[model samples]
Target: MKRIAILGSSGGNLYNLGGKEPLKLLGEIETQASSAGIKIAAIQFIGAKASMDNANESTLSRLYTWNSSEENIVFSEEKALKEVNGEAKKVDSIIAKMIEDGKVQGLVLMSSDPEGVNNLSIKAAAKKDIPIVGTGGTSMATIQSMGGKVIATSGTTGTTNRTRAVAAIQSLSRHWGLKYKPVISSSGKSSQNLDENIFQRISFRGIMMAAIPGFIAMSIVLALSKIPGLAKLNDAFDLLIKGLPVVVAAIAANQVSGLDEVGIVAGVVAGMLSIDGGLIGGLIGGILAGILAFYLIQLALRWNFPGTTANIVAGGLSGLISGLIVFFLISPIALSLGNGIRYIIELALNYNSIVAGAIAGLLIWPAIIGGVYHAAILPIVLLEMEKTGASFLGAIDMTGLVMVSAGITLANIIYPKQKSESAIAVPGFLINIAFGTFVEASYPFMFSDRLIFIGAILSAALSGVFVGIFNVKGTAYVPSVTAPALSNNALGFTISMIIALVSSFLITLFANKISRNKRNKEA
Candidate 1:
C-alpha cells in the first residue's frame, strides 16, 4: 500500500476555492481506489480546518463535521500551516517523517488555488518524484501542468454527486483492471448528476455493429435451413453457424460492461433478427412507438395531464412499445422467414459485385461496432455480411450512412431552435430525416450554421456516388469515420468521408452567416 498525503486548502488566500471540494474529491478518490484493490496506509488532512474556517463559517462547519466523522483521515494542522508560510521545509520534514516510517507513498494536493499552498506541495512532491492526483481543486487546464494524472467527470450541479459516484466506480474499475490498486483516500459522497443522454450517439453506434450480425446468423440457422444450396456452401454455412455464436457472446459482454439492461435486450433481438422481420420491425416499432407516445401524450394533455407526469408516461410508453414490437413481432417473423433477407443479399452478392461488397461491409464493421456503440442495429449488419462476404458495395453503404448521420447530429445541436416547433429552430427535422435514414444519429451537426451542414451532406452524397462509380467494397464495415483504417479501399472511404465532413462544415458556416446577415439587414 502506497501512502497518500491529502493536503487540504490553506487559510486566507485560496481557502474559499477548495475548502469543501477537497473533502468531496478525496472521499471519492479513496473509495474508488480502495474498491479497485488499493490499500491506504495513512491519510493526512493538511490544513483542512484552517482552510475551511477561513472560508464562510458554514463551509468550515461542514468540513469540521466531515473530518471528525471519517476514521481513515488523520487531521494535521501543522504541515498545512507551515506549507502556507515560506517554511515549506517544516512541511517537507513531516512528509519525510511519514516516508521514513514507510507510511507515505504519494501525495494528493486538493487546493483550488494551485498557486498558493498547492504550488508549494507540488514543488516538494516533484523534487521527491512522488506521484500526485488532482481533483476538484485543480482546473482542467492546469491539472496536467504539473505532470500528474487528473481525472475529471462532467455533470450539472444537481447531478454532480451521482456523476462523482459513477466516476469513482469507473476509475476504480480501471485502476483495478490495470493492477494499480495501492492507496486511496476520499471526501464525502454526494448525489447530484446529469442524464446519460450525452453519450447516446456513441452508444448507438457500438450496439448496431455487433448484435445485428449475430441476430442474422441466428435467424438463418434457427428458422430458415430450407434455402437451396445453403447447406452446400461451406463458407456461408460456417459463417451462419460460427459467426452467430461469436456475435452473440460479444453482445452479451458489451451489455454487461455498459450495465445497460435495456440496451442488452434491444441489441440481442436486433442482432438475432435483421431480415424477415427484425430490421424493419425495430425501425417501424421505434417510429410507431415515438408517434404513439407523442399522440397519446397530446391527447392526455387535453384532459389536463400534468406536464412532468405526461412526459414521463409518454417516454416510458414509447420505449416499452418499441421493445415489445421488436421482441414479439419482429423476432419470430425474422425466424420464420427462412433467410429471405439473406437470399436477397445473396442475389445481390452474386450478381452485382459492388452491391455484394457493400452488404458485406454492413455485416462486418458497422454491425459489430454499432452493437458496441448503439446495440440496436446489430441484426441488419450481421445478416447482410453473412450473405455478402465483404463486398465493396457494403463498404460504401456503411461509410455513407456514418457520414450522413454524423453531419445531421452535429447540425441539430448547433441549430436546435431553428428546427424546433417555434421560431428560430434551424432545420432539425429536415437534416435528421436525411441523415438518420441513411446513417446513424451522428451526422446532422456537420453544418450547424447552415452552409457547412448542407455542404457536408452534399459531399457525402457525392462520396456515395463515387462509391457507386468505383465499386469500392469491403468484407468489413467502415469501423470509423477515418478512411485510412477502412477494411478495403480504405483510402477511398477515408477520402470520401473527409470530403463530406469538410464540405459540410464549410457550407453550413456560409449559409448560417448569410442567414444571420440578412436578418440583421431586415432589422
Candidate 2:
C-alpha cells in the first residue's frame, strides 16, 4: 500500500469551483486503486475546505487536538490560522506521521489560484526529499520558484484532476518498484494522447479564463430573468441564456481541441446560430465548432510560413469556416432537440405541485446514481431560470437534500444512542449541500437504513411542494443555499428551507418510532 495526500484551499475562496470540482475525483481514485490492488493509506485534506463555521464543541475539540480521521471533521481553517500562525503544521504532521509509519510514499497538492499557504508541507517534503505532485499554474509556478522537489507540475482538468493525481503517484511508485496488482487501462487515455492528455485537461481550463466576460454575461441574465412581470423580455433573455454558453464554449473548445488560442468571434457566430437552444444547444454547438475549427486550423498551419500573426490569421479563418458550416448545418437539428427536451420536462412539471415535487424527489436519486441526471437536466434548469426566473424541479431536488440533512441532525437530537453515526453524517452533508450543491451524503443510507431513505424522500417531496406553492426561484443549473438566499424570492427560499427541515425531522422521527414498535412486536 502507498499513499499521497491531497491538499488545497477552499477553491479560490469559494467552496466548489476550482479545486473542489470533480467531486467524484476521490471515489474514482479509490476504485482504481482498489482494482489495482493498491491501498490508499490515507487521504487527508487541509485548510479552508475543511473548515466549519460555528462548529460544535466536539468537532472543535478534534480540530484542537489535530486527531486524524477519514472524514473532514479533524481539520479547521480557523484552527490552522489562529492556532498555528498560518502554517500547515497539521498537514505537515499528518503526512510526516503517515510516511514515518510506512503508510504513504508521496503527496499531491490540489492547487488554487494565487496559491494558498495552508500546506507549508512543500518545504517539509523537500527537506525529506519526498516526491510531491502539484496542480494549477500559479501554484506550480510558486513551487518551482521556491525550488521545491515536486516530481510533476501541470494544469488540471476541472472535472477529472483526481485521475491525474493518482497516475502521477503511480508513476512515482514505479520508480521505487512498489508491487501492486495491475489494473486494466483505457486506450488512448495515457499521458501521450493529445486530446485526452494535454488539450481537454490543461488547455481547456487555461482558455476558459479568457471566456470570463461571456460567462458573467450568461450568469447575470440567469439571475435577472427571475424578476417578476418581465414576460415581454423573456424571449430576449432566453436567447442570451441559450446563446452565451455556446459562444464561450466554442472559443474555449477551439483552443482546447485545436489552434492553441481562444476564438471569441467564432464563438459569437456559433451562439447566433443556436439562438433558442439554451444550455444544451450551446454545449453541443460549441463542442462541434471547436472540433471543426481545430481541423481547419490544422489545415492552415500546413502552409508552414512562420509569422507571429500566423496563429491569429489561422484561428480567425478556422472560426469563420467552422462557424458557418456548423451553425447552418446543425442549427435546425439542435433547435428541435432543444424544444423536444424542454417539452418533456415542462410536461412533467405541469403536474400538480405536490405530485411534481414527489416525482422529482423519487426520480432524483436514480438519475444521480446513474449519472445521467446532470447531463439531462442542467440545461433545462438553467434555461428555465433564464426564461421564467425559477426551476421548481431543481428546487424540489435541492429541498430533498437539505431536508434529509436536517432530518439526520434532528434524529441525533432525539435519539442520543445514534450519536456516533450522526456525528459522521450531519453537518458534513449539510455543508456540501450548501457549498457544492451536492446531495450525496445520505445516499449510502439507502442500503443501511431503508426507513431513513424513504422518510427523507417523502418529506423532501413535501418541502418540494412548498417550493412549488411559493414559486421559489434559483439562479442557475445547480441549486445551492446561496442561490435562494441571494435571489429575489428570499422569503420563499427561507420558508421552504424551514419547511423542509421540520418536515424531514418529523417524518424521520415518526418512521423511527414505527420501526421501534415493529421490533418490540417481533420480540
lDDT top scorer = 2
Q: Residue by residue across 97-118, what tens digits does model 2's lDDT show? A: 6665556666655553223343
Q: Which stretches in model 1 have alpha-carbon errors above 4 Å? A: 1-244, 249-339, 346-378, 387-398, 404-457, 475-495, 519-523
| Whole-model lDDT values for every prediction | 0.42, 0.50
Model 2 weakest 10-residue run by lDDT = 57-66
Q: Model 1 — which ten-residue stretch has the worst lDDT?
A: 153-162
In model 2, what is the error at residue 219, expressed in angstroms?
A: 6.7
Instruction: Write model 1 residue lDDT over 7-120, tens digit each, in one string.
Output: 544333334433345455456545645544454543433344454435343232222112324445443233334333433334445554665555655554434334543455
Residue pairs that clash (backbone atoms under 3 angstroms), model 2: 226-389, 242-278
Q: Quote the positional error of residue 132 for candidate 2 in Å.
A: 33
Candidate 2, position 418, lDDT: 45
